[model samples]
Structure formats: C-alpha cells, structure tokens
Target: MDLGFSQATAVIVGGGRGMGFATARCLAEDGARVALMGRSPDVLEQAAAALVEFGSPDAVGVVVDTADVGQVEAAFAEVGERWNDGLNVLINTVGPDAVGGFEDLTDEQWLAAVDGGVMGMVRCVRAALPLLRRAEWARIVNFSAHSTQRQSEILPAYTAAKAMVNSVSKNLSLSLAKDEILVNVVSPGSIASEALVGWADSVGVDGSDPYRLMEAIDEHFGHPAHLPRAGLPEEIAPVAAFLASRRNSYMTGANVNVDGGSVFT
Candidate 1:
C-alpha cells in the first residue's frame, strides 16, 4: 500500500521493539522521517539503524522513558526541533503489561500500572499537542488491546489502563477534531511480536514453527478470531500506518481492531 507519509514527521513512543518497531519500519518505508523513543539506547540504536537500512536516512533514536513526564516533554521538543515543518504523526505504543488478578496486585503495583500505561500516554500527548497543531494535518494513534473489549482476569490492571486509553482517545478525538488532528485507537489481539515469541519459547513452545507456536498460544491464551493462527507484528503495521497517514481523513475517535476477528467492535 502507498502510505503517503513522505516528508512527514512521525514520533513513535516505545519504538525500539515489537509492534512499535514494525510501525516505525512501515512509516519509514513510506518515506516518513521517524523519531523512535524508548528507554534502551542500544535497542533504539538498532531500530534506528534498521530504519536507515530500509531507506529512512533521517530516522533518529531518542532515549526517553515515557513514564517520566520531563523526559516525554524533552523528547517531543527534540522531535519538533528536528522536524521544523511540524509533527504529522504521533503514535504512542508505551504501556506496561500488568499481569496478575486484582488481589495479587499491591498498591504500588497498581499505581505503577496506572502510571506507566495511562498517565504515560497522557503526558506524551499533552507534550506533542503543540507540535501536532503545527501540521497541516496530524494523526494520533494510541495503542490499546483487544483484551480491553473482552476483559481478562489475569490482566486486570493492564486491561483497566488500556480501557482508560480508549476513553481518552475518544475524548481527545472530539476535542482535537476542530484542529484537524485525528485521534484514534488501534486495539490489537494476540500478535506474535518478539516479546510474545520469547515468552512462548520460555514455555517450551516450538517458537521456530510459527504455526505450532500460534496453535499453542491459542490453546492457552485463545485467539478465536477468523484466522487460525496468531497475528504478526508486521500484520498489525499496515493498519497502524494507515491510521497514521494523510489517507485516514475520517477515522478519528474510532478504535479499529487489528486482532484478526477476535473482537468484532
């Protein structure tokens, strides 16, 4: 697909690995100048190198911990400075995956989950608003999970945090619509990102065989969607790229599901 992000500036939080990296590559391939922000300098460097290899010479890696508001502000400032034209896309993929039931989580753990997942996104978006406003048109794609729709006992805190994200995205969509800034959410299901594959490997699944690993994951986690297998990071990228591009003019405030057929909404 022709994403049409050429000469556009994109800021992807948590872009060093997994689905974030995949989205970065997709945008970069479409000629967007991308800034990848993460906590790991090594991983960010590698991701930036890969983008450069894939034809985004202006791709940069910015070290920023999204959980920290100051860092988020600084990161966006740097992005604005680098891309003087404006910020066309802001894709926030930062969030803590909180496992364990309600009783299992302590006050600290619950606070951490809210801090990392909800407030982190809040801070980043608040900081990026100025840059986004400068563009002719801007797209804000916040990450959510399909688990938020179906609900999960094991991921109570995580689910709550993502649910908050969905709510905020919808509110922001309405608030920013007049500015021509489209805000939407992408809720993914069981995607076989690198992190998921590593977990499968640790659990003795045949990670080498995609089909086998996905089958095992389905048996355990259950991805009863249209496709029999788990989705890939690459599979989620096109949807994200589309939502983050100029082509998506009328999709604000929508939570587009990229989880196979897991959640119909």
Candidate 2:
C-alpha cells in the first residue's frame, strides 16, 4: 500500500479545490509532504489544514497566481526553502475553462484561455524546474480535459489550449527523459466537483444530490462514456497519485484519461 511517497515533497498548483484538492489528499494520505499553491488565501489555508488532518503534518499553503510569472517564481522558491529536501512532484492543475462558441469568443476571451490554460502551466513548469532537478526522482503531472478528445461547441478555445498542454507535456517528457524526470498528462471527463454542482444549480438541477446533478449534466451535455454517470474527484485522485509516485517509473508522456470510457486510448 505504501507507494514510497512518505518523504517525497509534492507541489500542487491550484490545490485549493476540486480535483487538485483530491490529489493533495491522496498524496498526503500516502505520507507525502504537500505544498498547496493557489490564489485564495482562505482556501489554501483550509486545504492545508485538511491535509494535515489527513496525516500530513508538514503540509503548507502557498498563495500563488499562476498567471503571474513573478508570483510563480516566488512561490516555487518559497517551496524549496520550506521543504529544503527537494521537490519530487509538480502537479499543474491551474487552468480556466472558456465557455461560448468560437464565433462568440472575443480576442480577449481567446487570450484569456491561452494565458490561463497554456501559459499557466508554462510558468509553473519553468519555476519548478530547478527544484525538480534537485530531487532524486521527479514527476510532472499536468492537467488536460477530455473535451480535447471529444470536441465541444462550447469549449473550442479551452480544448485547443488543453491540446497544446498535452503536446507540451509530450515534448517535455522527451526533453527530460535523459534526466529521468517523468512528464505526463491526466485528462478528466465530467468529474463531479463543486463547479459542476454550481453548474447544475444554475440550470435548476438539484445540487444536493450529486448523482442527480451528474445525470442532469449527462442529459444536457451527453455522456458518451461507457459508465452510466459522472466520475468523482476521488476516482481521479488515485491515478494522479500513482502517476506522481515513484511506482510510476516507466510511464512518461502518456495522457491518461480518467473519463470513464468516454475517451478511447
């Protein structure tokens, strides 16, 4: 059961909520020192406290704006100083979903998606490079969405940006192979999270019952997955944990889909 992550240090960008928080809990439960980096001070504090409660007493909350280059650099530097040992894993889950059709999207909207989705990962990876190099083994797990595989009319720009992220991850995998640093991507499909619940509420669906909300989403958005319903954050966390662990020594540049059979390999 021990994935050998007890002493490894993981920096999770956007670790305050949803899948990021779930992944944080996974690593922490396996005894990793986790630093949650996000923009919200309160959420970061609460998340870090929750991690500590989950058995990672050394968990830290790092407030960072991924879109800001300076903040990203400073945050990583602080993580290095705080951990002092090394950074074993870097998980970039900070990205925005741009809704609306291609024609409805303005130049500003397109740029926003690129800036938040693509450039955010770029900045985080650049900042974490030095710390990651210090570790004996390093893993970079980036987030993409299943929407890239099954295009959505409402998410053209977002999907394009995620495709770019997947491409960049593959390139990084090749470039970092010599260093023995593994780089990969995780594309999740319709994972039940707070955002989804809010979405359901906005559309007059019952948010209290997650399954009902998921069903509503599937009805509205069409779930092509073999599974009957949406996935939970916990369901996606274990895959990310394994990918971020030393056990995943051979898998690199692979975009693993946690989409409940919605995406075919």
Candidate 3:
C-alpha cells in the first residue's frame, strides 16, 4: 500500500471536494505533489491547504471549469510551467450524476450531462497527455459509475456518458500503451459523498445505519449493492491512488469496479 508515491506529480480535476478531494488526500498522504483543479477558488484553496497538512510538499490549487476547453487547456499549461517536465498521475472525478428520468430530461440537460461526464474527462486527458508521456511513470484514472453496468432507467444521460468514458478509457489504454501510460477507469457504486448525503436527506432517507441506508436506497433508487450500504469516499480513494501510482504496473485498458459487489460484469 506504499503506492510508491513519493515526489510524484499528480493533477486532479474536480479535486476541490467530495471523492476528488478524498483521492487527492490519499495521494498526498502517500507523498504525492498534488495540483487540485476546480471551478471554486475557495474550495480549491482549502483543499490544497489540507493536502499540505496531509503530507503533500507542494500542493497547489488551480481554478478551471472542465466544461470549457479553453479553461482546461489553460490550466494544464500553467501546471506544465510549474512542474517543468512531466505529470505522474492524472485523476478526473468531474462528472454528472442522474438528474431526472428520460421523459424529464431536456435537450439542454442531456447536453450538459454529456459535457460534464464524458467531455470533461476527455478534455483533461487530452491536455495531460504530453506531460504523462514525458513522465517516468504515468497513470490516468477516470471515474465512471456502477450504474453503467447495472443499468438505471432514471440515469440515461449519466449512464450513457459513463459508458462512453469506459469505452474511451479502454481505447486510450491501448493507444497510450506504447508510451507506457496506464489508462484505466474506476466505477464506483452510490457513494456517500456530500451531494449523495444531501439527496438522501432530501428524500427522507437516513444514512446513519449502513444496512438500513442501503434498504432505503433500494426502495428509492433500486440500487442495492450486495454489500448493503453506500460506499465512502475514503473507500474509493485508495483504489484510485493505487491505480494512479507507480505500483500499478501492467494493469491497463481495464475498468476496475469498486461498487461493493453491485457489478458482476
């Protein structure tokens, strides 16, 4: 579990809060130099400071909206100037969750979902490729979702975008293999992040008890994992850290599921 992360350069999109912050914390704790990218300057600043407290020597924050290609490219250009050579890891956690049912989704909503879920990751990866290729050890970890595997009627745009992510990740693994850049995907089940917790509370479901929370989720969203609980951001973070580290050699073109046994495929 050392992850061999000492002095590695990591850039995390959406690293301001939630699972993104959780994963960046894990990397920082293992001695990675993390650059957190997000829209909110305050959140990014707080996260970078916390990463330093967690053990990162050079944790920095950059403001960027993944929806905008210009912003994403500019952010990476700044990171390139800072690092001066290469990026060891690129982790993207910016994506849209299910908003409404198919009947409820407007053209604009669907477009937004694809922009956030698929193109967001694509933009980051495209910008980071040069740095990654120059790296001594490079890893790309893209976030997908368990819903992509099990299927959710209410999550059409989100699921479709994640499926595209999965497909694109596999292709990148193959294409980037020659450069020795490891490209993989992490598909998590429903995790107890801030948004999920707020949604649960809004729906009158208490997540205090794991089993009961899962039961309520089953009744509400029909998303009950075999483990019978929502996953924690901490639980998903370490797996991502491993994937984004020097220790993960020979694993590529794979979608690793951390969905509490919800996805058999």
In angstroms, how far off is 159's CA in candidate 2? Answer: 0.7
List, residue by residue over 1-265, the lDDT tens digit for candidate 1: 6777888899999998989999999999989889999999999999999998877878999999888788889989998889887899999988876778789998888888889999989998999999899988899999998988877667889888899999999999999988989999999887887777887898999665667776876776655566777788888888999999999888899998987787764
By TM-score, the better pick of 1 and 3 is 3
lDDT of 3 by residue, 7-92 (tens): 99999999999899999999999999999999999999999999999999989999999988999999999999999769999999
Clashing pairs in 1: none
Output the worst ten-in-a-row residue range by lDDT, candidate 3.
207-216
- Tell me the TM-score of each prediction against the true structure: 0.95, 0.97, 0.97
Give all candidates' CA lDDT scores.
Answer: 0.88, 0.89, 0.89
Return model 1's CA RMSD, one decimal. 1.4
lDDT, model 3, position 261: 86
Question: Model 2: residues >4 Å from true position, as ranges?
Answer: none
Where is model 2 poorest over a 10-residue stretch in terms of lDDT? 221-230
